[model samples]
Target: MSPPARARPLSKAAFSPTFSKLKTSIYTDSLRPSAPVSSAHFIRTLSWNAPGTLIATGAADRTLRIWNPEKTNVKNSTELRGHTGGVERVAFHPVNETELASCSSDGMVRFWDVRSKAVVGEVKVGGEPFTLAWTPDGSEIVAGRKDNNLIPISRSTLTTITEHHQPVQTNQCVFTWDGSAIFLTNGDGCVKILRYPSFEHFYTLNAHTSSCYALSISPSGGYLAIGGGDALVSLWDTQEWMCVRTLDKIEGPVKSVDFSFDGSYVVGGSDEDNKLHIAHTETGEYVYTIDTIHPAAYVAWHPCRYVLAYSAEAQGLKIRSTMDVQAPLNPSTLFSVRGLLVVITGGGTSIGLAIASALHQNGASKIYLLGRRIATLEKAVETLKSSSSAPHYVDVLINNAGVIGPRNGIELHESESISQLRGAMLKDWSGWESTMAINTQSVFGVSAAFLPLLEAENIRRHWQGSKVTGYGNARHHSASALEKIGTDADDSRLAHIITVASIASYIRRCAAGLVDNASKGAAAHIGNMLSTLLAEWGIRSNVGRPWNENNIGGLILFLVGNGGTYISGTVQVSDGGRLGVFPSMY
Candidate 1:
């Protein structure tokens, strides 16, 4: 493998990448590619244009499709149909931008006006032209014949410039990044490099024992990624032509390979089971695998953007936007609550019970239910323990259990007399103390009982997450501060007190009585304030546990997942849009 001639060393500081459509390699399922943009068919080849404005694909359907990926939904695609047989390859002119050329088993090289979908030029190459490419300068077109010659023709004249003889069973031909050399892949497991214009052989490399299929040069001319019938994508250093790394573990022959625009990532596609692999170029570590995309026959990275376009066994073209936001979906996925030790204060009934069940069903490590009724709590525990997969343990605490006040404490009685109205207000007065006690004052007792456990867990996860994310050694950097303060801050488990509050907390509402609304609202604010007060202890607080039946549990699960750590002082609404409709309590 040759070291890079023009490639710069990777930056020492990690790059914080912004999401650029799905092509940048983000780790969230929220932005995955939808179903294929086109219907099902055998797509032969796909290529993105120079400016990243369009994608061209040739299909076994004997037709060509031009896609405009800028449209988010990609609804406006133009079809060009002049080929009488299966199209083999499509190339957008590197310099001309507006023109594209395609070759087909139909025995012709046709030039196209990308906008009008009209053929501006055509040349009949003898026999079927299987592969085609444009010179980096866009001065000529080169088509590899099914026979033994590479035909280079002038772009302006559409006349043959020269025919370079290649060994029989040649698969494809490509130019180096600087257009300084031409690389040829022969089916006999070798790559031959030759100088341009003079066509003098520079070197012959034994690349693969099996038939070679794809070849791509890094934009920096520093590396080459090649794959063939050998079911591997080998990374070769361009400077020495020595094989630097081999990305194996693929099931079938690799059909295509491409480097990201900046040469940071290598993308490969396998015809076997149609899996696509994205690997970090420097580390040579496989970063992502998108499986079952169908057999991708061709892969092309967008020239100016972080998008990838490919043609599989479908209606021809699939364009994927890549981003750098890659989060693994395992036990530690972004919105997952798996393996969490949880405690719900009101776990025996109502919304509290629902929260408990949501956590139980989704793989919480252990759960401790807290409620005034011991019998009910026991029953709930048995019910939960019966189906849970992970061992149950008492871990975190939630301040979710609460009560409501009289529905009409602040409303006028329908009774005609003033005496009737007086009774309505006075009847609920004695119960008001209990309402406030259970609804707004229970946090002190519940948190006191479980605060230690929560803190312990926080400390454990701090080290655990830190170690897993490559920050283990850095923890010692803060050891001095911890020793000087003589506090548990460094080893504290981020146990949080999660409070469930209704939307009424932020709005002026008396549906459940002014006092009830006021108490609940105070509870919500207290949860947020707790964070600031407990900042030194590493104990955080957040208000708002969404009910699962209402996608609030989904939000609450998110709050408890990895996302929960970053948030501590906000009121996240999980009300199914009911805040706007203002539904009445029955």
Candidate 2:
């Protein structure tokens, strides 16, 4: 629970002195001042192009300045004006650097063409604007108002199309990868998502114990990083709409966080200590710290470069590179394959639903979910589709139907009458038969019905990778195998078959003199047999061995992602490794 070492504050004199000396020694002969300008009124936000060649800053001076940071005598090349009040935040169009959006205290958000320094359009909300976000397509802009409402503005018409209501003051807001939704953090320690265009409440995430301030989505938008008054940064899985991990005991309230373009490193800024801290996104391990006395307003990781940009009071804008440092590689960058179809059965249980979510956040193109209950399946599907990126990918199917049944038997006990036993038998028979029918048989029916759609995806991957070795053939093999099964193939195209088997499958209970009853052990035998059988077709099957409700989802996630890619043909047993040492005699 110790605070990250990178959260320490830096002295202004010390940082600038070293930076100045380094600058003087490296380019002393070429260094020159570009006609000393007036003191900056109030610096708000800073941004850089993907290449780190150009820099942009929004200031209270009512001017947006674009600069060439590479030159020693860097000078402002263009000054943008349109905002009537102090520009509080600025974000560059991800794909087009020539365009950018600025939010001001005037309750107006203006989109500008940086190259022309012309105001393309403006969106007026009701209150002071605190934050602005652009969709992945750059087609829409989301503005966060002081009253905690989020307004989605169309980039074309510059008019508000949707507004999200927050019960508390909204500190920040941003869109998911595909830009179909907006994630907003309130000062009341809550984060919620709203579907774009429709403005429907998607999911409400409660993680922090204090006010939530800043929020940043990983490059893939699979994980969300939140900083708040609690002085901690928590990572949440977008799929399950729940908190996965929390990095605690920081020096101060985090004001901002930026994930590396590759999704490996996370850099955060603290308001209390006025310092910048870096950590590994996956493990939450502290990396390093940059000392700065003045509170940092914003931080950004260059999309394709090693440089990181931040605004410091003493230093107008500072750039640092991890190129020379041996930093841990980013896990988010490892698997960049987009548009893969993943199907999940048993989506009603916490674990099954969690796996589907983790896959979606990690960049899976489509998710096919199966379960028996219509209500649960509908809720899960709605949660996934609410994300902006969800529409681009398809939800092939979510079967929320299941049944369980007895192989054969009718027994009477001394404590119950024949009629009572009959009633119990009827209920158990109905439940068991229904469970197996939906959990096992229905899965086959749905997969069979969706085989053609899955095969079509395979062909697309084949065509996309025709020039690459092994890719086209791999896709073809997958497609042909999936098609041949025609939904009846119980053991094919099972990229990840997550079974929520009960611990009772392994534990032996001798209560009521029912000693050594081997029938209850059938589930374990069936799971093992199915796993071994499925391995032949490249499908991996693993069971979620959760000992408690809390760990159910995590165990399922471990088996589905890269961590479980090599783990096939075996029951995962998610009892946190305790099951390994426990003695099981049956």
lDDT string for model 1 (1-586, tens) is: 1111111112212222322114422111112355544332466677776666677777666768777775534346777889987888888887566688999888889999978889999988878888886667777778988887888888889988878777567777888644678888888878888887677999987888798888888765667888888888888887898999988867788778888655667787766647677777766776666554567656787764446676556434566674323411234455556667787888897777777888888777677777889999889988888343442233356788777776664454354678887775665687788888887777766666665666565444422122211100111111112223332211222456788887667655456675677778878877877766654455667788463455656767777765454566667776666666764331
Q: Report how far off residue 333 is in candidate 2 (Å).
A: 18
Question: With candidate 2 superimposed using the best TM-score fit, by how many Å does residue 136's alpha carbon deviate from the native?
Answer: 1.4
| Candidate 1 segments exceeding 4 Å error | 1-40, 72-75, 322-586
* CA RMSD (A), model 2: 21.4
Q: What C-alpha lDDT values do all the predictions have?
A: 0.66, 0.58
Error of 2 at 544 (Å): 46
Estimated TM-score for each candidate: 0.50, 0.50
- The per-candidate count of clashes, in order, stands at 32, 26
Q: Which 10 residues in a row give candidate 1 its minimum summed lDDT?
A: 468-477
Q: Best by lDDT, which number?
A: 1
